[model samples]
Target: MITGVYSMTLCDIGNTSFHFLENEHQFKVSVEDTIEHLNLKEPIYYISVNKDGEKKLLRKFPNAINIEDKIVLKSNYATTLGVDRALGCYGYSDAIIVDFGSAITVDIIAHNNHLGGFILPGVEKLKEIYPNISQKLTFDYIEKINLHTIPTTTNEAISYAINAMIVEPIKINYQRYNLPLIITGEHGKKFLNYFNNVFYEPNLIFKNMKLLLEMEK
Candidate 1:
């Protein structure tokens, strides 16, 4: 147990941001800011995809537990499997996890065995590419999109295409696996209406961190 802090800070360091949750409060801080601002004396539990950022975090909090080293994944996952994906699927029965962030991940876990997954470019990346590919296809609007119908404009087309791309693969996986679907990540809830069988658990990764702490004791 940490000597001074009342609760542990759990961080999920991704490609673009560092997400922190302590007790019930959560916030997103830049990796650099987190390294500079986080209290070094407090206990920290973190899972990271960025090696250099992880090193920075470790340097600041030498006692912090890297969640990757502590959690045991019972599966055939390669070394490249992300800790975020693992954390999202942990402590579940039979489930398929779809995380929509910098990149989209759809992973399966059954009977505690992480059964491999697929990765695709995220919607933001597609939006970036679509503009460069064709100036005529550009959509300058930044309004909330509803993907319930066919597109009549460039913005809607882009929204429709990316959402369809994300949804179709997930549908295929769900049909094949026939398991409960768990969706988590920055954009998980936005696609909730499109997916009928999905359970949106925004705090999955943090819950995984908590479970790790409990198991360690």
Candidate 2:
């Protein structure tokens, strides 16, 4: 339902990076970079889960607006839920939203009402676990995982375990809810092989941001 040209810039600030959408072009800036050096001319409407980054960005961009309050959606989630997770549920009446970032967040929305969901360690974090247990256990994740075949080697075992850890819970939830599965974030597309009725939207947050901005008008 949102129509017309969107000339404004939108940002989603996280702990490690600043994700930006300008005239449909998306890019990221590292948190270590100086914000003022970017010399952005336009006003940026943003949402932030990173408190320190939010403060720094606000000081650098006087015209920047935080649109967190403008994102009003039906939910029964606790007050402590991350803004990113809440926004993922936007425009979805019944679905499971899985965001694969530094941490994977799974949120459920049923009949336009957000039910509470769970979080799991992401691929990077899961990779870290084996190394901590033993030096020999350290191994990179495989590109392709065959769930049906039993793992024979150490690498295969680790790979299968990692995939199962991430995928099984989602499968259980999908079976319980029987709703469309929505996947987003950095590793969203990689998960498409595991589910049948799954959708991958890398710019989900940005899409929701645009919709929220339109509602503000």
Candidate 3:
């Protein structure tokens, strides 16, 4: 059997998952299991938010560039911002990017200014937190139900609360900034109803990666 060399393989390494993309094929797995199954002997490109995970990925695939290193932000902040946030806002003059991953982040860039954003636990983490606060508040009974404005049952209440807690801040910031909204990450697409003019681009990181590669060449 001939082993095919994958081109433009992009990995967005995050705290909770490693999203691997090759052309149109996409795979997501936990960080611990990624190295074993990933076909990365050849050159690849990646972006990592977890420092330790990045180190491990580098040890496994030395040829790959940490795409974050190639990025040059046009704006400044008091504290350091995350590279993933930078990439999401890259190439956009004015926009809001809501990344719904392990941690939900609402990154804002308006008029080429990196205004920073809000961060909160993702819906899964939020659900985990509820059970810790009270065992009776467990989400074991909850299914992936569409959020309702006025929830009637316990499960509905928890579901709505979880979704609202994540989306409300993004909605508020979008209204406040009045800029274009670009949603990405795991749960990014499910937020379409929250905004009037929002776009779901799951490939924002990969698009940024490709741009970086083109700049290098």
Candidate 4:
């Protein structure tokens, strides 16, 4: 639509880090590098950022798009909309999405591709509560979420709490809805032990982002 070739620079900044993808190229930069680059732009630009990093990145890129402060207008209905669209395109319906990143989000997509249910708090969130609870306890949790009845120490107790807080609710919802579960995040492996019908797709978010970006233009 332009006179010259214009590449899209999409920076998906999460609670943990920034994922910089430039058009079709894989321009991966760390959090520090990204911050420095943002500051270099004279006129600055609108940058999509997380609620946590909004203030910081904005201070750097004064004119950057603060999507964190403003809600994005979406073709799909909800935050889970991107995943729903992609999964539907791939002919995947009746599935549960367990995204375990900063937040463990358990979202259920109905057979008709509508969002049917939801839950939260994956492994990381549980581990956050551990160190404060006891000396031996640290931010350690399984990469998976499953059944472990015998949680001996405070660390184990936190895991158990996370399981009960996150996984068990999903279990209940899955039981209620009767859809298969699909997990994606830093801690997908831990889920392998507990669930039989679980598929781990690490780039669910990336794929969704790509889809949403496409729809934007």
Q: Pick by lDDT: which candidate is best?
A: 2
Model 2: per-residue Cα lDDT over 45-96, one tens digit each: 8999899888888888978998888777787877888888888888888999
RMSD to native, candidate 1: 2.8
- Residue lDDT tens for model 3, 29-143: 7877747556753567888888878887788777777767778777766547888888888788899888888788888888888877778887777877778888888765344
CA lDDT, candidate 1, residue 60: 76
Q: Rate the local accuracy (lDDT) of all candidates.
A: 0.81, 0.87, 0.78, 0.55
Give me candidate 3's TM-score against the actual structure. 0.86
Best by TM-score: 2
Q: Candidates' TM-scores?
A: 0.88, 0.95, 0.86, 0.60
Model 3 C-alpha lDDT versus the unseen true structure? 0.78
Q: Which stretches of candidate 1 lie over 4 Å from their true place?
A: 1-6, 32-34, 140-148
The collision pairs in model 2 are none
Give the Å error, residue 68, model 1.
1.2
Regions of model 4 farther than 4 Å from truth:
1-9, 22-34, 38-93, 111-113, 116-119, 131-149, 152-155, 212-217
List the candidates ranked by lDDT, beginning with the highest: 2, 1, 3, 4
Better of 1 and 2 by TM-score: 2
